[model samples]
Target: MMTGTIENRDVFLANIAKRFGRAPKTEIDRPTWQYNPQNRVLKEATKNELVEVLVEQCKNIHTDIVITNTANLPADLQKVVGNYGGKSVITWKDERFQNYALSSLMTEQWPLENIQLYEWDSEQPEENIRQAEKANIGITISEITLAESGTAVLFSSKDKGRSVSFLPENSIILIPKSTIVPRMTQAARWISEKVRNGELIASCINFITGPSNSADIEMILIVGVHGPIKATYIVIEDQ
Candidate 1:
């Protein structure tokens, strides 16, 4: 396995700094933009309006949208899985599933429905990838949701693998209403704040918009050619 070790990065930078007759800067102070236009778009939009905007954008991306509360999420999720023709499922081993009352989904519901469930095991990464590759549907909880582009920001940790979102035939995203932002600007700000606070960011941060969309040589629009064939966003109204 390649560790991607950069053994001479500091020395290389130091040589460049020496050629310029200056020391390498450890930090840079960027000028704040006097005119910020990103904060203006959907600035006045209410939480409900943001949800509406997300729904409208989903239409263009060919993604299914489901609005459900915490109480009905398990049932609604089951129905969605069935709609997507899912026979097996793969999901991240996240604690948020228990927080959102989905802990019994695999133990109770999927067992009753005779659907196989696979949880990503960090210790067995090879098996995890194989399960994700074979699973019919992959489900994940979004840490941040952008309403403008209908995008879900997922911060991948040891328990969260990116393959669960990309290698499956179908993708299901669970988005809480509280995590919905006006656009990517808010998401970027959140990440910047984390970095500024000297917090360790996840190794992988995924900005998944929808399923894989591709065009053929004839300009024929094809969905899910090499990635997930379908994607669904389940937005929780009351988290």
Candidate 2:
């Protein structure tokens, strides 16, 4: 009788585990920013100014920049980013990115030859994760990023595999101004749609708020302990 009861209990626990995903004991909370379309301060800001603000607020000891569009970068900043030994990775969605006009720093004569370009299509699950671990910067596009909480939704797809965004040391997300939404509930609705379409795998979905941080050691503050040390969102202005 005892053995049968124990087996039943074990089965029940297993069922619960299957339904709910595994995560750490604690998670870092992110700061939220409310969206105001009428606010001319944010809306009127140029891409350069917006990028500058992101860098100012988010930069820390570990700063790896992942840029989505190398082609469209301003000429002056190109030389500066190159000197920093930044890694460049391009997403496969050229048609969708057509509006931004992203280009690479590596050209015929001015070869940023050292800057490695990681094509999103070539990575497998394990390899993608491994590469991301070694890479300091991960630059990619967000379908509908939120300024409401500095949230960037990385929809998990085979083409974009999860690791490309999650595992890197630093993540620089490129969000066109048009995609910013006002609330988390709206983002949740979009996520549900993707899940229904059979695009997302794994029961657990992650929403990162800011750079990874911890104060475990004698209550001393430390950054980049659990995840990327820094995360910046580039709100590309269409205007």
Compose the digit string of candidate 1's lDDT tens values, residues 1-239. 66777899899999999999999977899899999998999999989999999999999888999999989998999999999885899999998898889988956238435888999889999999999999999999998999999999998988899999999999999999999999999999999999999999988999998898898799888998878999999999763
Task: Give candidate 2 regions above 4 Å deviation.
Answer: 1-84, 87-99, 103-113, 192-205, 215-220
TM-score of each: 0.87, 0.56
Q: Count the backbone clashes (under 3 Å) in each candidate.
A: 0, 7
In model 1, residue pairs whose N, Cα or C atoms come closer than 3 Å (at least 3 residues apart or on different chains), thus clashing, are none
Per-residue accuracy of model 2 over 12-33 as CA lDDT, tens digit each: 7667766787432334686666
Lowest summed lDDT across 10 adjacent residues in model 1 is found at 106-115
lDDT, candidates in the order shown: 0.91, 0.55
**Top model by TM-score, which number?**
1
The 10 consecutive residues of candidate 2 with the worst lDDT sum are: 102-111
**Superposed model 1: Cα runs more than 4 Å off:** 1-27, 216-219
